[model samples]
Target: MKTEIIWMIIGMGAVTYIPRMLPFVLFRGKELPIFLQGVLKNVPFATLGALIFPGILLIQEDIWYGILGAGAAFLTAYLGANVIVVVLSSIAVLTLYSYFV
Candidate 1:
């Protein structure tokens, strides 16, 4: 059982390492196109929104909680605030909302 767990961990490590290593190895001497670079830069933001969107719609007790929090986050982010500020603003909005109602 211990051996199996060890082997599973090793296998998982290799599976993760290969995909990460391949990009560096294959792109060592080449530069990505300008359009591709721009798209890649935005990937994290797009992925964050994709991950958060569903949770916003699935709020159980009150849908307004999610909608208000999301709105606060969006407004903060739209004003050029960084990720921490965006998240903090959202939390503050929700806290106040919860306190009042």
Candidate 2:
């Protein structure tokens, strides 16, 4: 509600928005090479792995908890489930593990 907070939010929005817009603006009407396009298509998966792998490894309460969750997610993803399904399947598996154990 404060003026400073409003300006800060606007500035942060612009900072994040500009980079996202740049790729579309710069690449519009330009064809990327097939190999580059393929690599770019996998970027999100790579980023998600990088973010989640550490948490999976570092779970302190019980290592099997992380391992089982990751295993479920990996299997779901390997079977070509959507990303949301992969996440939900992992949660479902972990919930069952907790309930039964």
Candidate 3:
């Protein structure tokens, strides 16, 4: 059992390390193409979309609630509301939805 656990840890570590290390190692001292750079510049937004899109549409089995919550967040963000305000608004919306729905 101990040996199996050790191997599992080692395997997981390797899997995690390779992806984390590859960009630094591979991109180091290299000038990427302009299109590639543009794409890379948008990587953060793309990643955010990937992380937020799926579950952002489904909260408490009501997809519209999630959409409204996201819209509130976006509006707060656009209006320069601080992080606390944005988060509080989202929580307030969801909480009110829970109680009323």
Q: Pick the candidate with the highest TM-score.
A: 3
- Per-candidate local distance difference test: 0.88, 0.89, 0.87
lDDT of 1 by residue, 1-101 (tens): 69999999999999999998997788853389888888888999999889998888577568899889888988999999999999888989899999999
Task: Give the clashing residue pairs of candidate 1, or none.
Answer: none
Clashes of 3: 0
List TM-scores for all candidates, in order: 0.61, 0.66, 0.74
lDDT for model 1, on a 0 to 1 scale?
Answer: 0.88
Q: Candidate 2 residues 22-59, lDDT tens each?
A: 99889963389988888889999999879998898567
In model 3, the clashing pairs are none
Poorest 10 consecutive residues by lDDT, candidate 2: 24-33
Compare the candidates by lDDT and give the number of the best one: 2
Q: Candidate 3 lDDT, tens digit per residue, 1-101? A: 69999999999999999998998988863399888888889899999999888778876577788888998899998999999999999989878877898
Q: Give candidate 2's TM-score.
A: 0.66
TM-score of 3: 0.74
- Enumerate clash totals for all models, in the order shown: 0, 0, 0
Model 3: residues with Cα > 4 Å off, grouped in runs: 1-3
What are the runs in model 1 whose C-alpha is more than 4 Å off?
29-49, 59-62, 98-101
